[model samples]
Target: MGSINYDDSDVLDVLIIGAGISGINAAYRLHDELPDKKYLILENREQLGGTWDLFKYPGIRSDSDLHTFGYAFKEWTGADIAEGKEILTYLKKVAADNGIEERIRYKTRVNSADWSTEERCWFVSTEQDGQQKQYRSRFLYTCTGYYDYDAALKADIPGIQNFKGKVVHPQFWDLKEDDYRGKRVAVIGSGATAITLIPSMAEVTKDITLVQRSPTYILSLEKYDPIAKVLRAVLPQKMAAFVIRQKNIARIYASYHIFRTFPGVAKKILGRLTSMQLPKDIPLDPHFKPNYNPWDQRLCICPDGDFYKTLREGKAHIATGHIDQVTNNEIILKNGERIPCDIIVTATGLKLHVGGKIATSVDKKLIKASERFVWKGCMIEGLPNYALSIGYTNASWTLGSDCTAQYVVRMIKHMDKYHKSMVVPEPSNRDQLEEGPLLDLTSTYVKKAEKDLPKAATTGPWRMRTNYWYDLVQAKYGGYDELVFQ
Candidate 1:
């Protein structure tokens, strides 16, 4: 109930927030590289696997392939794109195998973190077991991710309250309680969640309709990768995983560059591929065709073309238009078209909440993340002994977070070797650098959180390059001249 002191052995060398992918990777790196250092991970949830544990909607799976999404330190043997439960199992195994499970404090919610210049340590206030607790650590790392776990982005649906049928949001879906057997369902939004839910809930429901304001770029890919199978057959498990990971990385990277460089040609090719898999009755114009260029926003991936297959099998339908109103039985489009439904699923986009909604301050002055610049894609400007993991938009999330974890470990080791207590990022000529959004995506979530997220420069270590290969080498051997070691 009272404040804790870092004066003696009670303090930890490193305190990690979250038990998600980034946090797990950081924990592994700390134990592997700095074995002598004492650290602990605080997980707000009772269970591990942050995203996989939170969402329980039907057909919940990783959009990115597991080969790249899984940690580099571990080899993944599951399907390329695995379901939520499978991924959660994998995470649990990783934690147990590495002994990270013992280092975690479950159901611990970090409320605020303050850096004391005099003590050269972080004072973290948390709520655990219905009691306020405090912990001190020399370094603080946040892996709570970029989205709000407590809330999702709210959509403006007119007359939604008037609907007599049950309304549900994918974020708050209950697997055990909710039943949709033989009931007509309407899923709103066309992002990855909506696209996934449509195919997953199609067979169980009588009929499912995908209701979207506009179309998003969608691509069909083989879920069980044939190339990975061949690689594993010829190589050792770890060797094969490494090779497969690099292959997947390069494939996505080259495709992303091609899509950006020649959007017209790329669009034509993608459109043709999507059309080939879709039914003739479902035109490419109104439903499949997107207004934006490929990679402008994340492309919705359907494993083994399941989304398209469901449409062909007459289990699913897509209606693209602005919602005019929602009656008790049907959703009226602005064009006067109507689609009847008994259940409404709002799969609206995620809401970005940086630093896990944990207030951070230095010497009692609040640290505004928006005003700070990202240093080496990990540390924030003027923030001492702190780092947050934000992954790449184009590739696997782990690929980016792994780099951050390693980079953070490197910084920690460097400070130890030099006998320094604080390492702070200070911009060199901040006024001259051209600043822009940290993430290079035009997604709705990114746009809405622009004022809350940190800024990135166009040049130097402050820039956040989307390339994993480049980041891998840079994170290992990058210069730290911009950082002031105290």
Candidate 2:
């Protein structure tokens, strides 16, 4: 592909893509540190709140809490596990409060980004309002996340088209257009989304069955913390909120260490806790038991024990087996059981994608992302003057993103001080480094995209880590010895 130009194109110091949590945090960091730098946010959707706004399915909420998930600069004074709408509203407020809303161009879809070594800038081709346009920026921060919006990752169930009832994924759900009331709904998968949807949708639907290949570790916490309430009642709001967030952060950090280090003990403890949530009548071993240990995969978090309550009340049922085929009015299980269904929801999770489907090249040579190395869990190896905002898998995503945003600001300031036009991270010896999965996860989605995902190093700044305090020290305060500034 050749470079294209637009007459009305205006150059910028930075171009932030996707105005979700990462983009908002990036904007705030840039505004605070480099007030004079010119920047623009190109969002493909017509609105803000990337995941929260896009997934409008029933029982939509954060699997993680607001403290770490929220920005480091702002305090989320609402419930820990906030509803999707509330979270989206919070993101919009953050953007508006920081004066970043005016700088956003909605309905702008980025098709490709090409980096020019001669110009030291990225030429981005985009389609906005059905018009082809181009924009140039010295720095490109991709907050587009790692998922495909138009397509969802679902198991290719045999004979799905023959099903008489409607089949849907959580990504394309429209409640107004299709009603589930008085319907027998079958929700597939056992991820956080399916667990949340089964309970939330069961309240309105006649009977909903959760179909799962295997069970996931389930956990619960109150929507509102009593500790937060007492602290806020006694102390000032900001101080209380800050202390609470810190306390929660510490607890969660310790839990990750414990679960990883002592899987046997952690699994037993998690199983006991999960069993406590259910009533005596409901059997625990068959439905709630998982073969994997705790923290092997993400624990499904339910607020106020709603999912367990739904199961105990007989509003929903659990079916564990593979699908044989989808008939006209039901799904036949491999075990020869036919599950009647009026609607089938394949809450089978999302596929991992990077760069928001942007066809990228450097110096007219196409850049194959899977063949590159990941640096500090954000930037890619051999990619200069650009950073990608990817959050931590274990902890809240914003925690890592916040640190990366600060690092980007720091790099920009460093280049400005040295009068350098470009900065790249070059490992002392790339071939000698040991490599593994970018995201050290065992989930099906991660496994499916293993070939396309970037490689993670065994040690040093090149490795993508998950610890918050450690990442802050390495990314924010660590020296740029590995970075080439010129």
Candidate 3:
């Protein structure tokens, strides 16, 4: 791929941060829809694919099916719950085929961006290969995910420091360097990471234990979708992919709504399904039953019922209780049970960090995102010509992000047609607007970082977004009368 020439004098139309799934989608949209616009993707890492490239944990896969998670422009016929490597490969292929790969500048870390009212452009400072560099752009779009890549949320288990065995966080796991063969492994936390690790490491380790304070709602999904297979065999490839994607999208949207609308019924349905997978000896009262209602937090997905199968086979076990402490060779629980293990995998959670900690300012005045509101769940209030991609918590991330990319493109096109240089969201009714969280998730990581993210509204364009169908329609045809375009 050809490299983008660094020229401080040349002002690009857009400067996108991160080469993750969102950034790639943004680049594709800009190139395909607005071909005349010059944009560049700045990735701090040496490779693209963001999370897919960053996490090398065993049995790492998408919780959401790939049909919805995959790009709308691209058709994915692979397994619904795609593995990490396959997802990375798909991302690379999308970038390559679309000519977006050449426009990406790897190892370029953006530090700060300041908007100049007088110049009507942004001056961005970055560090590449230890050399400070500068660039100018008319608009800035952040696709860096809402998590701190440099650090994982620390596990709070008491006496963890005193444990004389190998301790690992899934975020930083090395399959080759960290060996777990024939050793007893204790995975802490009941989230997606913990469940994924249990099934993947079960065959290698003598026994893997899932140690959690409480149970998380787990759902079993078929690895391969028969509907997709039947459609592919009958319809054309592209048409089949499109239909399958939409079907999955509707399925998830309906499921989420059903779960939220009828919590008791949803719980019973999930419980019955889970009971069929687990062995009768292991009851569903404490270990499998979650105290909270369904969809209170994102449900953990086990592909092909592997998580339960591993448990039924006696290779994986679950222990639900508060951890009292960790001895040199055992994890002591509050219930007076000791779990002997050689390795402790902390699949605790992520630490949310938005905008990659890029210091943003307007006219030399510092802009704090936490103090502002999100406009249309894409742009920040009072921030000119800026957009950020945040995906849906209830469905595939790409569905939300793809809409965001489309929305940004629409905004840019509107600006171009109207000959406007800057566009920012400033509602005249800001004072009367009710404040809410941009992310609706109740997960520990989200709650911990609630104060650090942009606030959401209860109504209008500034309202919190969850439904992709609504967002898709809004992104294409939503009114921008509330925005101040100049």
Q: How high is the CA lDDT of each candidate model?
A: 0.89, 0.86, 0.90
lDDT of 1 by residue, 241-270 (tens): 899988999889999999999999989999
Tens-digit lDDT track of model 2 for 1-486: 111232336788899999888988998899888887888889999998999989989879999889778876888889989999999999999888777887789999999898998999999999999999899999989999888888898778888899988888998986642389889999988999998898888878888998887888888899998888888899887888788888788988899889999999998898898888777876677778888777778888899989998988989888887899889989888989788999999988898998788888887778787998888887888888889988878888888888889989988998899899998778888978898778877888988988997778888878868788887887667788678887
Which whole-number lDDT from 0 to 100 does residue 90 have in model 2? 90
Better of 1 and 3 by lDDT: 3
Clash-forming residue pairs, model 2: none
Residue 431 in model 3: lDDT: 90
Cα error, candidate 2, residue 429 (Å): 1.0
The regions of model 2 sitting more than 4 angstroms off are 1-8
| Model 1 bad stretches (over 4 Å) | 1-9, 175-178
* Best of the two (1, 2) by TM-score: 1
Which has the greatest lDDT? Answer: 3
Per-model TM-score, in order, reads 0.97, 0.96, 0.98
- Tens digits of lDDT, candidate 3, 1-486: 333454545899999999999999999999888887888889999999999999999988999999999988899979999899999999999998888888888899899999998899999999998999898999999999989999998768899988999998988986553389889999999999998889898988988899999999999899999889999999999999999988998999889999999999999999999999998778898898998888879999999999999989999888989999999998999999889999999999999988898999999899999999888789999899999899988888888888889999998999889999999889889899999988887888889999999999999888888898888999999889689988
Model 1 RMSD, rounded to 1 decimal: 3.1
